[model samples]
Target chain A: MTNQLSLQQRIQMAFPGLAAAYSVDGLLHYRVEKSRIPELTQFLHEKARGRLALLFAVDCRPLAEKYEIQYLFAFASDHPWVLLTIELAGQDRLFTSITPSVHAAQWYEREIRDLYGLIPQGHPDLRRLVRHEHWPKGTHPLQKAFPWNKTIGRQQADYRFRHIEGEGVFEVPVGPIHAGIIEPGHFRFSVAGEPIMQLEVRHFWKHRGIEKLFEQQTLSTAIALAERVSGDTTIGHSLAYCQAAETLLHIDVPRRARYLRSLFLELERLHNHLGDVGAICNDTAYALAHAHCSRMKELLLQLNDRLTGSRFLRGAMAIGGVTKDVSAIELSEIVALLDGIEKDFAELESIIFANASLTDRLETTGVLTERTGWDHGVVGVVGRASGIDQDVRRDRPFAAYDEVPVNISLYRYGDVRARLRVRMDEIHESIRLIREIRANIPQGPVAPAAAHRPQPGQWALSAVEGWRGEILYFVMTGEQGSIHRCKVRDPSFVNWPAIQWAVVGNILPDFPLINKSFNLSYAGNDL
Target chain B: MFRILKKSLKTGIVTGQHPHADQPAESPSQAVCEKAMPFRQSLTIREVDTGSCNACEMEMNALANPIYDIERFGVHIAASPRHADALVVTGPVTVNMERALKDVHKQTPDPKLVIALGDCAINCGVFKGSYAVTGPVDRHIPVDVRIPGCPPRPAEILKALEEIRRPASWK
Candidate 1:
C-alpha cells in the first residue's frame, strides 16, 4: 500500500499546477483550476493509470461562493484514491469536458448539466441525463435552492432516439411499461428484420429524486434512504453510505463489525447471483434450471430473514458499524445452510452445463467486446465477463476484504455464457468466503455507542463491490453536521450504456437474455 | 432428464395447501387474514411497479417457487392487464410511471381487484415525501387490497392475493 506522504508527493510531482492538496485516510485530495481539470484528469487517466471511479457535481454555495465538481480516480495497482475537485465561479458555471479523452465522463457531465446546471463546455451529448421533459427548464433539482417536495405539472416532449436511416430499417420502442414484473426503461432498437443494428436506452422512469431526498435527511436516516437505492443491492449501497459516513466521522469500526458486514455482502452476492443465473436460464426456456435456482435463492432469502429482521438485509447497517450481530448458534446454522446450498448448487451446475441446448442459447448471444467494456468503464460481473480484471474487493480492499482475499473470476469471451460462467465462479467463491468468515467469527460489539456528528466541510468517498458492480457513494457534510451533498453512483449507471453495445448484432428475441445477463438495476440507475 | 425426474420425485409435494386447508396455526394479523378468506380460488394478477426498490418484486417472484407455488392455488401472473382479474402494484407512483399505472388500471376489466404490495405502494413507505414521487398507488388509482411491509414476505403476499380472490360476501 502507498503511504499518505508518498502518495501526496507523487500527485504533487505529477500535477505541478495543483493549487492546494491534502490527504485523508490515505486518499489524496487536490484542488485545481477549472480550466486544468480536463488536462489533469487526462494525465491521471493516462499517466497515473487511475480509473475514473466517480464524477459528480456538488452545489456548494452554502459553504463556498461557487459550485464544485469532484472527480474520484482510483489506482487499482497502488490501492489509493485521488479526488480532484474543481470550483466553478460566476453565474454561468462552466468547466472543460473530459469526455473527449475519458469516455466514462459522458453521462456524468450530462448529469451535472441536468441536476446542478453546470455546463461541461465540450461534452458531445448534453441531453438531459436525470431530469425528464417534465422538469421545467432552468430548474435544477440537486441545487440547494430547489425544494425537495416541489412538484411540476406534467409536460410532454418527444425524445429523439438515434435513427439508423437505411433500407428495411424499423424501430421497436419497448417500455417505460414492461410486460414482466420489472422496472421501467425505454429501449429504442433500430433493427433490420431480427438483427439489431442500433440500440438506444432512456431510463430514469423510476427516478424518485434519491439524491435530493438524501439532502433532507440526517446521517442516520440517510442509511434508510441508501438501502432503497436498489433493493437487491441493500447491503452494498447502505454499507457504502455507512463507510463514507464512518470515514468522514473518523470512526474506526470494530473488527467483528467489519467481518459481519463482509459476511452480509457475500450473502447478498450469493442470493443475487443465484437469482440471475436462474433468470438467464428462464429466458432461454430452460425452466427446470430456473426452478431449482429459484428454490435455492428462496432458501437464502429465508436465511437472511432469520438472521436479519428483513429478508433483503435492510436495517443491518449503521453509520459507525452494523446494527445486528450474529450469535454462535445462528452462525453455525448459516454454515450448515451453506453446506446444503453448495451441494444442491453443484448438482444444478452439472445439469446446466450438461444441457447442450441451453448452453447453445447462451453462448455468443450477446457479445460485449473487451474494447467497448474498457472504454465504457464497465465494472463488476459484466466487466469481468468482458475480461476487465477489476474487483473493488480485491483491488481497493474495503471492510474485511483485505483480511480475506477474493479470487477474481474473469472471462474474455464477452458473451452471455461467459457472463453466466463468471457468475457461477463468483457464487462458488462467495460460498467459500462465507465459510471462511463464519469460522473466523470475531468476538466484539457490532457497533460503537451512538454515532457522533461529522465536522462541517468534510468530504469522503466510499466504494463497495456490490453484487452488480462497484457502488460509489460520495458524502460531504455542510452547516451544523448535515449532509451537503450525497451522490450515489451505482454500478448499473455505468453498465447500462454497455448493454446498447452488447445488443447491436444480436436478434430482438435475444435482447431479454442479453439484458438478464447484464441485469442492471433500473432503480439504481434512475436514482 | 431422468436425474431431474428422480430429484423432482425426491422433493415431492412441496407446494402449500393454503386454499384447501387453513395454514398451520400462526397469529394472523386481522388486517391481512380477514381479507384473505374472500379470495380463495381463481385470480389473474397483473403487477405494475411504479417505482419500487425491486425487493417487493423479489418476494413476488418467490411466490411462484416450489414452496410457495401460487399457481397451484389458481393464481397466475398475467402479462396483460386485459386478461388480469387483479392489478398487483408495487412501489410509490413516480411522475414518469403514473401514466402507465393508470393505463394498466383502465385496461383491466370491471370488477377488478387492485392489491398494492409493499409499503411504497401502500403509502409511499420510505419515499413518502420525494418530489419525483406523485404519491402511493392509491392516490392515483383505487386499491382494493394493501399488503404492507418494506416488502412483504412471500407468505404475506400469498395471503393477500388469496384474500382478494375470495367472494365479496366472505370479506
Candidate 2:
C-alpha cells in the first residue's frame, strides 16, 4: 500500500499536469494530457521499471465525448498496475505514436487503428493489423456507431508484405489452411535456400469478432465467451475474465473457491504443457517421446473430465468464483492423477534429455534471443524461456497464487530446448502448486448465489499467466452492468510478431518446431 | 538410445481397440451409395479449421493418442485433401476462411465426404450471428456427417470415424 501510494506520488510529480490519480481494484488509474503519453510511457517503462503489459483503446462515445486509449504498465515487483488513460476528442483520430520509443505498443497501436480507426500518427509500418484484405475500408467495428452484427460487403484491397529481394531469395507462402490439424494462419517466409531471411506471419484467419461479441454479453454470460477465446487456455482466459468481472462488480470470491480456482488453473497448465512437450518432440520426428507424452496428456485430460466434467475445464469457472466444487474423493483422485503424471513425466523428461539426437535437434534451433523477446513484449513461458523473468502468478498474484508461492525456473538459451525446458519446469512447478492447494485448501462455498452489479463506466484489467503466457482481459461496464468493451489480448498477439525474428537465421524446416515451441493460439490472437 | 528403447519396451503396447471394433465391416449405406462414396477399410480424413476455438482441434489431435489410436481403426489423417476420403472441417465458417474452405473442398477428390466436426462447425454454435461468420460448414460446403459437442470427446470422434468407415453400421 505504501509502495502504491509513493508510486502514485512519484508519477504525479513526474508528470506535472497529471489530471487525475486514483486507486481502484489494485490498479492506479492515472489520466494525463494526450500529448504526455509517449513521455509517460518512457518514464513508466524506464525510470519506474515497468513493463507495458497492455495497451488498448476504449470507445467512450455517448457516455463521454471522446475515445479513451488506456496504457497498462505492470512492474516486476509487487506494485499496483499503473493504468494511464489518454482521451481523444470524438472527432480526432490521430495520436502521437509511442512505438518509436516503447516498441511494445507497435501492434496495439495498429490494432487500435484497425478496429477503432484511431491512427497513431507516427507509428512505423502502419499496415492494417486485424483487418484482412476483404474487410471493407473505413469500417471500424469497435466504434459505437458500427453495430456488432452488421454485415459489410467485401472489398478489394492489397496488403504489401515486406519482401526480401536477391538472386537466391525465395518467398514461401504457407497456410490459412495448413497441412496439419491446427488453426489457420498464413506465414510468408523470405528464405535464401534453407535458412530464412525473414518470416512474416499474416494471421487473423480465425478472427470471430470475439471482442465485439463481448459487448453483446452481460457480465454473467461473458465467462463462456471468454473460455472460447483460446480453447487450450480456457481456465486462464475465464479466470482472468472472472477476476476482471469480480473486480468490476466488487464480488468477493469464497476462500475455498480461490484455492479450487488455482487447482483448476494448475490442472489446465499441466495438461497443456504436457501436450506441448510431446508436440515439440513430435515435430523433431521423435515419435517415442510424442507417443508417451500424448499418453500422459490423455490421462491428465481423463482426470480433468472425472474432476470438472470437462476435459478442457470449460464450465469450471464462473464470475464470482468457480462453478463446480471438488469433493474429497475428487481431490484425492486429482492427487493420485498428479502423482502418476509426475512419475511418468519424470521418466519422459529423462528419456527426452538422454536422447542426444533429439537434444541436438532442440538445442540452438529457432533461437529467440532474450533481447528480442523483451523488445517485442513477449510474456509467459516463451518470455521466461528467453530470459525475461516474468510470471503473472508470481509477479501479480491472482487466485490462490497470493497465498501459496510459485517457483519459476528461468532459462536463458531462448531455443527449442530452452522452451521445452521451460514447459518441463512449469509442469513440475504446477504439480507442486497443485499439491500446495490440495494441502491448504479451506472449506467453504464455491460461489455465492447473490448477484452483484457494477457502476456504469467502471473498468478492470485482469491478467493470468496461462499455459502459453499472459492472457489479459480489460473489461469495461456499460449501462445496467452490460459489457461495454472487453479487450482480450492473448499472449499470442505480442509473441506472434516475435516469431518472425526468431526464425530469421533458422532454416525453413525448423519453423514448425519453433512455432510448436511457442504454440501461440491462432483463435486467441485472431480474436 | 537403449534408454528410449527400454522405456518403450517397459511402457509396452497401450493402444486400445477402436469403437465398434467387435463389429465386422458392412456394406456402404444407401445414403453412401447415393453419394457414390463406398465405405472402405481405411478412411483418410483431411482436417480444415474454419474458425474453431481450437478445442475441437485438440480433441481431433487426441484421436491419435494411445487411448484412441484412430490409425489402428484404419482412420488416417491425410496431409492433403486430394488424398483424403473425407474432409473434416471444424468451427463456424468465418468470412476470412470462407474462400479457403471452398478451395479446400474443391481440392478434395471426387466422391469425398465433407464432415462438420464440433458444435461450431455444425451450427455456428456460440459464434452464431456474428458478422464475421458466414455460417455453418453446411452453408459453405455440402456436409455428409455432423459431429456435435463444443468439442466432442475423442471417443465420440472415433465413433464418427467408425460410422464413416462402415456407413452400413450407422443407423
Candidate RMSDs in order: 3.1, 2.4
Candidate 2: where are CA atoms >4 Å away?
A: A1-6, B17-29, B33-39, B167-171
Q: TM-score for chain A of every candidate model?
A: 0.96, 0.97
What is candidate 2's CA lDDT for residue A75? 80
* DockQ of all predictions against the true structure, Cα-based: 0.61, 0.69
What TM-score is obtained for chain B in each of the predicted models? 0.82, 0.86
Residues A159-222, model 2: lDDT tens digits: 8999988899999999978888999999999989999998888988888899899999999888
Question: Tens digits of per-residue lDDT for model 2 on B75-125?
Answer: 888888889888999999998899999999999998888888889999998
lDDT of 2 at B144: 81
Instruction: Tell me the tens digit of each residue's lDDT in model 1 across A1-527.
Output: 34545656666787766644766554777788777887888888777667787899888777777888899887654556888888887575888999999988889898889888888998888788777876777878788888999886766676667789988999999988777878888999999999999999999989899998888887767899999999999999999999998888778999999999999999999999999999999999998889888888888988898789788998999877888889989988988998988988888898898899998999998999988887788999999999998998987788898888899999999999999999999999999998889888789988987556677778888889999999999888886667888999999999998899999889999999999999999999998
Candidate 1 TM-score to native:
0.95
List where candidate 1 sits over 4 angstroms from the true fold. Answer: A1-14, A450-452, B17-40, B169-171
